[model samples]
Target: MHVIIFSWEYPPRVVGQLAEYVRLLAAELVKNRVDVHVVTYHDFLTGAVEEPDGVKVFRVANPVRTHVGILTWALTLNQEVERAAASIYYQVGKQVALVDVHDWHFIPAAVTLKNAFGLPFAYSVESLEDHRAPPANTPYSMSIKSIEWLGFYEAQRVCVKSEWMRDEIVRIHAVPKGKITVVKPKANSWIRDILAMYKSMAGGAGKN
Candidate 1:
């Protein structure tokens, strides 16, 4: 099985746990003979593509713009991810097995990829725009929230770290109550949860 993962950060570009989590997940998947491809941002000195531990990683450059807000940068980053992914999808001569996308940071590209390839994407929601208390409804904030809504609505699966986040997803995005999987962050359980999520996603795809 193959999974194309999208994230804003990865090893050597460590934004948070997301980067480290993805690194561990990809390495473990490779050991299990699963083809894991990561699409992320290129940090200061890393090349566009890195093949660490047999996990194929494509990093797109997302340089900061002087006047543009973070959303604009995110959109531009999505374009880079999409272009690289399209190239790989054609070169491999196989449809991507599943799209494992992380948050709204990469939703623009993930949505396009899913629609273009007719694949179901599993969204990992780390946080939500609406759950961030006051000023969370500002223009930029609301825009990101809408993107999150679209992600939940379009996803075949949703994974979250805590029940609070799961509730936030259901309440804020209006996703079905039973659709979210709660995965703990402990090292041992996280991998099992991810594997189960992948199986669920793959099984759903088969039904389609």
Candidate 2:
């Protein structure tokens, strides 16, 4: 199956565990003989394409930095996502079966692809609104909440990392129970061993 994954982060530019999870997931998908292409924002401003672990990764420019306010920033991010999705959809041809998005931030890209090519898009909701603490008066939080609702409405299947998120989406967003799927993160043994080695080295250094 040709799968186009849209994520906000990926390996070598990790903001959190999601990037690592995406890298591992894409690698596993490739091993299973699936053609995976990932599109993410290039933090270092490098427009480069590379194949890592049989999965193609495309890093594009983030156009949201020009926005001075939080709302505009979110809008610009969605705009860049639309632009990138268009390019990927055109290049990948019309045989693509699925457009899988890693988070709500990549919803615009998934929606764009689905709308353009009439494909089914699935969403992996790593976090849900009820899972997080109550929002403050900050504009960032407000903007996120508003845009996230659109993602929920757009996804054909909403995959959650935890049971809590699955229930939260069903109860809070009123998404049908049939539309949600609970999938846990698969651990990569090689990556775990490498982390253990790094931790051991750090511990030895701390003792010195």
Model 1 C-alpha RMSD to native: 2.5
Cα displacement (angstroms), candidate 1, residue 171, comes to 1.8
Q: How do all models score by TM-score?
A: 0.89, 0.79
Clashes of each: 0, 0
Give the Cα error of residue 34 in candidate 1, in Å.
Answer: 1.0
Q: After superposition, which runs of candidate 1 have C-alpha atoms over 4 Å from their true positions?
A: 43-50, 63-67, 132-135, 187-189, 206-208
Lowest lDDT block of 10, candidate 2: 199-208
Clashing pairs in 2: none
- Report the lDDT tens digits of candidate 1 across residue range 56-85: 888777655453687888887788888877
Q: lDDT: which candidate is best?
A: 1
